[model samples]
Target chain A: MTGPLLPDLDRPKAFAAPWEAQAFALVVKLHERGLFEWPEFAARLSAEIHAHPDQPYYVSWHEAAVELLVDKGLMEAGAFLDQARAVVRFRASDHHHVARLTPIAVDPARAG
Target chain B: MAGQHDDHDHDDHSHGDHSHEGHDHDHFHRIHSEEVDALLMSIADIEISARVKALEELLTQKGLVDPSALDAVVDLYENQIGPKNGARVIARAWADPVYKAWLLADPNAAIADLGFAGAQGENMVALENTADVHNVVVCTLCSCYPWPVLGLPPVWYKSMPYRTRIVRDPRSVLAEFGTVLPDSTEIRVWDSNSEVRYLVVPRRPEGTEGLDEAALAALVSRDSMIGVTEALSPEPA
Candidate 1:
């Protein structure tokens, strides 16, 4: 129980992506702030993993934190859902902008 | 109701339920079950920063949590504490034969002597890597790492793929990380099943006779301490 559910020897990088580090920090910070206890968070995480076994672990942690906040009445359910939609929209646009990057073509007529 | 959305892929796992029509966010699909809802939202590819930011703002406004105090905690782990502490331990062991003997004999006490003992590191065993043998650490049940020395566990360490693959074929796993050992060398994989944590002390690289303990510590990489790689050799001046 103390160790992970699966055991592998592959040495992982400290942070595979930036968002992962953010997710990790967010949970640690929330735990330190007394928003929820470790056992409570772990239980919620377990429930989340049980519900959806394919999702990443930190994603489960993120979802569990949000669910805990809503269940505890700390966050308005409606508002949090709205925020999540808005975030998806924002990220989609951000991804689009990065994905469509192209070099600017110089116009000969405008060249000094 | 729980398994109803199981057929749907997680990316588009939203459900259309018109229960609270008066709220005016009709496009917002609400799943009443907390676990299912959270699972859906997590796989929806929602921006983590945005979600965490919104949560922090709401909690701060409601006086449920403090933003600055939360930042302080993040700053402590991300910056102030990490593998450097473990590097220092490795360097000391390399310099003093007596300390190395003590570290091999009793890791918990020796690690505490240097003031790096608490939480997940309460019980520990040091595995020394020699020319003929190498040691690597893994936690099959969960990511139970030696936090005091190595800092937070890496993302892949807690990942399901790593948890499942490393135990079965350690040589191939190490090879994926660009660590190819000699056929004569033996690979020992340590399963951190109980409270007892394991730390890999890599053999000191050659051609560093003139370097001091501090410099030697600088050569130690996080991967070396994890036993997947070896310390870097000293650079020519």
Candidate 2:
């Protein structure tokens, strides 16, 4: 948890979101599973924190996992982009969408 | 701990035009009087939270992203997104024979019918595991997975040994995953690619005959969907 902390901050920040906790857990789990060493993750996290000091802490955790995993070939660089773009597209294919009053009824015959 | 976000003013409730199933399920819940949001926006003075939120707002104002979509993405990854999406699909397939037929015939359509379609998951193929044969999914070239339903691949899924060894020795690999099929059953390994993503529909547990879709869905795990394990056995009656 130690990194370049904001001077005015008195206490350590807690995970504000589920993704934050997931990121933290992923790193720990990966380390436990021998995917990478704690020191490797620490170095990656330190570099990421130094790179984006103002960004949320867990963002660094997420990015460090990305960096480390991608470096290890455990995660392909393109796959990460595909995953992100897919999540975005899953929610919104475009910037705007019409609000609907009811759920779209599924037509069993055709639905793609 | 996340529920402790209760301090953010719950006043000025606005639910007029809001629809529960409007695709963007919790979108309009943000309209809790722009005043509170404005104050949250105004306070970049301190608190890591305000800064993170401001970044999201900045991205929204730039039109690079939709606020509702952004929240939906975060909300999804944080809570909703996971094998649950695929679990529902499997549950539906098991519950309705017609859906099973449709899913096996045209997986993308049947899966998208449940609202789980996106990039990296354009052409889905549902592999139904049965008594005669077992099915598993892997991406030997890279981590090509159905992100809308499975999120990202687990650590071992992306490991070099798993990527290479599974194809060469699937039985041993399955055994390593603690998934042992009968000697008489055939093991089939499906390699996932950029164009096509595979979701393994595990064999329905025996005692689940009377269970409804949700109850059945509860028994489905991420490993089961990936073919590393079977759906959880039903609770004793």
Candidate 3:
């Protein structure tokens, strides 16, 4: 039950939406394998934001949501790239309509 | 709703002893969500206010989430939403002749002189606004901002849509923010990098030659700093 928990639904603005949440959840699962705790994840995120005060909002689209999970050990860094590629590949075909919700496929090769 | 706006300057007296030792970092976070709600509510007269108002209502429901947990959320808003520290530097540049010279020579040094410290600020350059030219800043790669002077950024500024769209077509993006400028005005877009951040110091409005620095600073808005709009006339006495 303690496996990578998701952000509360009410805070959806913090993340883009459902797909974005899925991306984050995948990262959290990756971090769960690494054994990082939620508090640590929170602290590291705050530190990253604080460290770049002048560049206050310096997080890119992909890097902002999913990458933070990796940065905080909520996921592995390599896992993000691999899953991203797979996500793109899956979306490029008929899989988008067929799947009820595409489960994020973490690349085993990239799994840390 | 106005009560929330009035609470912005609230400070607990219990922390006077431990204020500066980094312990107070948490204190700022504690009240941040309420402050952000108030801030968004205060500025709800704008176009984006409806969306923010929806967010406030959805998130404020009892048992759905911790009310104070929004402190982090508000903290996030503060980072991306407003006339950042960089813009403040621009305002200083406009008003202070000495600082203007310093900003032109070495923006980083001039900014530091104002006592706002940060890593990215160490290598900054400011673009001064004029009647004919306007400067807008964006971090296409990420959401880099100047947080020293500007309290916090509005929620919409941090959205992916704003980030991706603004750099490619600043005029369109600015228009959405309620800025309507003449085509004759040249808009300069500054791409923020990891080491350097840029702020636009807008020219002072006319008929304000006698205003003090405090009064002038009050006229500077987050939109003006972002180059979406020019500073308007100060309130009549």
Candidate 4:
């Protein structure tokens, strides 16, 4: 018996994950704000595609935005990554996360 | 094991031994037993997602970014702009001969005239499919699609397989997409770049000459405008 004709697809959002949606929106928003040009993002994205051809399009696209942000000196590489680690920890441990909408305990680590 | 986080208002959905010390990360306090596994994203997706989320929160806190503006961008792409815009264009081209000629001659102005223009869609070239010829568009280097009309391209469209294969042997590629055309039809594959985006105006399906623009627009699927498939034929009378 066949499982189904077509692969199951999520109908709502284009990106694979919720973060991809935010990442996409952020890059477009940043470009609109003139922090960097579309071509600048495009160039980085093109290079990223070549660098990691196997990775998903948006994953590379997200990295391209991060690299561009760091390149333009608008964002610091170290702090940004550190915050990302903090966020991962926060999401996992914090009870008030999207998993539970109760008043969040800012995990002092992430708060600062 | 589940009693550690008794502080949270566990709504009595159900519970499991989901919260052990090492696995504290699965802090879905009140979630059902069945939902625990479903709620946990793949480790890779979770990592990248967390990183991007971190970037967004940090930027917002620094006042370097406006959360509302990000909201606006997501909302626009998610809802307002998509292939429906392109379908309308294709439908117009089919219904109005004058617009078809104008779209073929100058797509940017013709497309922008319909208010579907900006960003990746600023430079537009409308490729028309005819009885003797067929047109298909691809961005070989990356997923450079026409956003205003096509919206964000589908997952398969951006995949390496589709990008590489579509250009090499479009007939086989189109066949895989269930777009079988006659052997006599000349298939033209157009490579899209950042400079110029291509929107294929598929041949209108036979019958239903009486159908108005809105009805015709409804028949134009996203893939049809992309040239991967032909427009849907009107249902039996």
Ten residues in a row with the worst lDDT in model 4 chain A?
A: A103-112
Could you give candidate 1's per-residue lDDT for residues B113-230 as a string of tens digits?
A: 8887544313677889987777877665455566567765555665557766777777778888888877667787775533466788999999878889899999888778887788
DockQ of 1: 0.06
- Give the alpha carbon lDDT tens digit for every residue of A2-22 in model 2: 234322122134333324434
User: Can you give the DockQ of every candidate in the order shown?
Assistant: 0.06, 0.03, 0.02, 0.10
Order the candidate numbers by lDDT, best to worst.
4, 1, 2, 3
Best by DockQ: 4
lDDT at position A101, candidate 4: 16
**In model 2, what is the error at residue A66, expressed in angstroms?**
15
Model 4 chain B: worst 10 consecutive residues (lDDT sum): B6-15
**What's chain A's TM-score in each predicted model?**
0.62, 0.69, 0.39, 0.71
- State TM-scores per candidate: 0.50, 0.49, 0.46, 0.50
lDDT of 4 at A96: 24
Task: Please write out the lDDT profile of model 1 over residues A1-112, one tens digit for every residue.
Answer: 1125211122133432223444555566666667777778778878887787786665566688888877987777778766555433332222111111111111111112
- Supply the DockQ value of model 4: 0.10
Please give, for residues A5-90, the per-residue lDDT of candidate 4 as tens digits: 21112223354333456677787777767787676777788788788877767677778888888888888877785665545454
Q: Whole-model Cα lDDT per candidate?
A: 0.58, 0.57, 0.45, 0.64
CAPRI classification of candidate 3: incorrect
Candidate 3 global TM-score: 0.46
Candidate 2 chain B weakest ten by summed lDDT = B6-15
Question: Where does candidate 3 chain B have its weakest 10-residue lDDT segment?
Answer: B5-14
lDDT (Cα, tens digit) per residue for candidate 2, span B73-141: 333343433435888999999999999999999988898899975442147778888887788887654
